[model samples]
Target: MSAPSESSSAPRAVNPVLAAVAWLWVLVPFGYGLYQLLIKIPALFGG
Candidate 1:
């Protein structure tokens, strides 16, 4: 048995799958934008 204050103060657990999905949600767009920039770099130099 635990105290009410201790339980309330404990940090909530996060699901790994949800965490990964959240990370990918942010990274995927960022990665795509970076790829687009890289693709355009050669164009900028007329390559």
Candidate 2:
């Protein structure tokens, strides 16, 4: 019935170690994808 509180919806503060881990979590997958696209795709296509 009542609207949700905005404060309760605010983003939580990230711990430094957790933040670094999260950044690597994103970068590792992205780097692997890029490596597959740039290197593996070219090898498959005889480039």
Per-prediction TM-score? 0.60, 0.49
Tens-place lDDT per residue, model 2, 1-47, is: 67787677769776899989999999999999998788767667787
Which pairs in model 2 have colliding backbones?
none
**What is the Å distance of residue 24 in model 1 from its true position?**
0.5
- Considering summed lDDT, which 10 consecutive residues are worst modelled in model 1? 1-10
Q: How well is each residue in 1-47 modelled by candidate 1, as lDDT tens digits? A: 76567457658787799999999999999999999889989977888
Residue 33 in model 2: lDDT: 91
**Global lDDT scores for all candidate models:** 0.88, 0.85
* Residue-level error in angstroms, candidate 1, position 6: 14
Against the true structure, candidate 1 reaches a TM-score of: 0.60
